[model samples]
Target: MTVNLLYSITGLLIFFMGICGLMFHRSLVRQTLALNIAGAGIFLFLVAQAYKSDTVPPDPVPHGLVLTGIVIGASATALMLFLIGVHQSVSKSSNDEGERGS
Candidate 1:
């Protein structure tokens, strides 16, 4: 099989794994990780599609887009983690107050 096809297939498999993880897991952290995994798979697939062959030069536009997407994905993941931390803290505080009242 061609390297590009192999990469595309691998990317799709990874994306499928991520989707399964997201569906099966209940924890927000796990879901966030799954989302990131899915994003990575898309990036890989795009990279694979960007290539033409050894003779012809690869497309630069897709590469640039992938790079930009990676940055956005990282920022989004960080934001999600931060929100999770905030939620956990809020719930913990509320639970502690409830226990004290009881």
Candidate 2:
């Protein structure tokens, strides 16, 4: 098969794997990592589709979109991690308070 086709297939596989991981895993960290992987797959697919052929220049729009997506993904990941940390701390403190009260 063609290189583009191979890239598309690989991206699909990665995306599916991410979806499965997100659905099956219990850990917040694992789910976050899976979300990142899915984002990467989408990026790859977009870039691969942007190429028309070897002679023609690839579309600039997809590249720009990918850059924007990367920035958004990074920000989202940071937010998720921060939220997870806050949740853990809150739960820990609540548990400690309960123990002291007993």
Candidate 3:
């Protein structure tokens, strides 16, 4: 098989793994990580598809879009993590105070 085909298979496997992770994980952090893993798979797939061994490289449009997507995903994930942290901290604090009063 060709290198490109091999890459495609690997990319597909990564994507499936991510999907399974997202489905099975219950905690917010785990789910988020799973999503990020899936995102990485997509990025890698795009990169693989755009690779041309003996040429100037595949089209620039997909690369540009992938770059933009990566930036957006990173920012969104940062915000998500912050929100999750805040939520967990607040919840734990409330639970602790309730226990102290009991």
Winning candidate number (TM-score) = 2
Q: Please, what is the whole-model Cα lDDT of each candidate in the order they appear?
A: 0.96, 0.94, 0.85
lDDT of 2 by residue, 1-102 (tens): 789888988888898989999999999999999999999998888898888899999999999999999999999999999999999999999999999999
RMSD values for the candidates in order, in angstroms, are: 0.9, 0.9, 1.6
Query: How high is each candidate's TM-score?
Result: 0.94, 0.95, 0.86
For residues 1-102, what per-residue lDDT tens digits would candidate 3 score against the true structure?
A: 878678767878887898999999999899889888888888777777877777575877768878997998899899999999999999999999999999
Error of 1 at 45 (Å): 0.5
Off by over 4 Å in 1: none
lDDT of 3: 0.85
8-84, model 1: which lDDT tens digit per residue? 99999999999999999999999999999998999999999999999999999999999999999999999999999
Relative to the unseen true structure, what is the C-alpha lDDT of residue 77 in candidate 3, on a scale of 0 to 100?
90
What order do candidates take by lDDT, descending? 1, 2, 3
Stretches of candidate 2 off by over 4 Å are none
